[model samples]
Target: MKGNWLLLIGAYFSAVFYSTAFCVVTLHVDPESHYLEGGKEGTLEIWLEGVQNSEEVFEFTINVSTNNEDVFEITDKVLVVGSIKSKVPYTTHKAGNALISFEQVSGHHDNADNGTIVSDVGDVYAHIYVIRSQPLNVFNIIVGWIYFTAWSMSFYPQLYENITRRSVVGLNFDFLSFNMLGYIVYSIFNVGLYWIPKVQDEYRDEHPGQLIPVKLNDVFFSLHGGLLTAITIGTCFIYERGNQSVSWICRVSISIGLTYILTLAIISSTDKFPNCTWWHFVSWISYIKLIVTVVKYCPQAYMNYSRQSTTGWSIGNVLLDLTGGICSLLQAFLIAYNSDDWPSLIANPVKFGLGILTIIFDAVFMVQHYILYADAHYSKSGRFLSGGGSKKGYKKIHDSEKGSSENSNFFRT
Candidate 1:
């Protein structure tokens, strides 16, 4: 009889154990990453997500860790927060990226300490940036905006120059062709990563616990750039294009680009490479854009060099490109120093190389315009210039535009 009673008690405990799970308590960091000046301090809040309908007051003992001890000093101690949330303060000793993380030591609830167990989530974390110059943070931010705006605005000058001169005589067709192809592929990459849920899911699944790198601004930039390039290409068709055509070299390059993407699409359809998924396709398109960035300016630069003049090519474009490139590189330096993330530059060599390469090409263009080929003015009338090549083209354009050129924007440059 006693054995039967004991068996009934054991059966009851087993059922209870099988039916219930430990209550989970979630802790969230307010800002996943934050910036701070050297020798300054700031606080990041830790908010608790507890079981629903339970008004139980909870407290936890938290522990802290940091990546750089010299730049950041945080000792692991008991964090006693007796409410739903608490602010954690950190101090930056120097200029370095300080990675801060928190661990839960123990936790308690006011009611049902035994029957309702509280399960602790692994960790809550945030970043601490100790920038070299606090005042320069604002400058860095401004430069970031400047580069973005400058790059976006840079496209207009060429478009205007084509309309103003009524000819794309000195504008190398090779440059346009490569640029158009690049923007198209870039738009595809950005749109896929930014909007397509399946691609995002694939990206996240491939890189677990990592944030999606693409943002709405990225989408905006690529799409805006693509639209502008398309319009410019359209203008090429209507405008008086002198003795120039999309070079066979550029045609072959474009063919390769198309073939590369299409072949990847085919491979993705098959199971040849297990890892060649949707995200891989997106990444490959981005690679094409990267390659384009590296080489797009070559044709334009070479064309200027050959012509011994900066006639059709816009100096405004060169100036804006220079502004964007310089700002971009400086901002990169500021960010890398502040975040102690020098490796990230290496990780994204395409973007870094793009900035450096652009700056170099801009310098070359500036030298060509200012010193190497300074004889003639980049004038729309081409009347005062010494070159007959420009004169002949602009005279034809002037005759054609005598009726419509009055409304041309004088302030376009």
Candidate 2:
């Protein structure tokens, strides 16, 4: 027991150390700048440095006016700077040179001594600073893949145990139903936000200089979750225990199907009217997913409480799920740090809350299994505390005519 406790403590610290190291290595801010001549209505050639791809593009904007309130009438101009393949230093003149000229304007300076001071037009120098994005480090990538693998395989142990036992006695169908619907909506939302061009364009416009592209592993993770839930639902149908209500299956299916159809309709409308409509639609779907995830575990927890036993439920699944959830939350933090876009975490509250909620439910399940109902048992000898049944209190019965009975009768001492 002492050794086991030591190992658990060591593992906990190791995880924390590794996550800290990963954040330090991957998250960094490296700002690069260039100076351009700015004055009258003219253009300046801005050199692009460290741009490898000819198709790469950067958002360029010029603020020609002074910071003083006396010169606040100048309007800012925004432009796209694309890489030039033929250039020696790979510049962005082809896309459009920086227009560093602003209209001449005059404004009153609110000074205590001077009642009003008018400012004249002057030459304004522009400093172009680009917020460069660094690709994820190899260690972070490996950790992400590990998280994906753990999440993808989390349900397999429970599925295998159910099959081996040929009973779904301990598993709560309501929980599975909610979980399936949640994953379906989550998968749709992820794909719509990532693959839909309109949504992607809006996201980029709203959040400039931030990289939040959805990876292939993310798609796989959602799909895997949906697939596992579907399998579990099938198993429930096949091996449903005595007198259990399986009628909820049809209701949940129809509701999910209709919701999916409506989601598709909203996504399709984006093609005709392309704008921020898709973003709103996807956001609603994400909220639904979050709410479902938050409530999905309640039914199972209640079931365990009412029955006073955790029999037939696999603890292995809970442990794996806990590990995956912690890793997922850590990965999200790392990404937010790396991109320097902490607001993005709040922008997608569902994704932000999923890992935390999963870990909480998994911990509750562990408590229910190993702590609350540790000695409770459901057996043929009737409901009794584990190790309470005694062979000495049972009498074997024998039949005549060369027949013997394996049944035994139990009596109190």
Q: Candidate 1, after superposition: displacement of residue 192 in Å?
A: 3.6
**lDDT per residue as tens, model 1, 1-413:** 99999999999998766554344556677777767777887777766664442454434444434445567755444343433566667667866765555555455455545423344344344556777776688888888899999999899999999888776667777788888889888888888888999888788677643567887877888889889888887877776654566767788889999999999889877857868987898888778888888888899888776555677888999899899889888888877776666776667776887778889999999988787766544445532233223323322233322223332331122
RMSD of each candidate relative to the true structure = 8.2, 22.1
TM-score of each: 0.74, 0.56
Q: Ten residues in a row with the worst lDDT in model 2?
A: 403-412
Which candidate gets the maximum TM-score versus the true structure? 1
CA RMSD (A), model 1 = 8.2
Candidate 2 lDDT by residue in tens digits, 216-254: 677778888999889977876665343334335435654
Whole-model alpha-carbon lDDT for candidate 2: 0.54
Off by over 4 Å in 2: 1-137, 196-212, 246-276, 333-351, 378-413
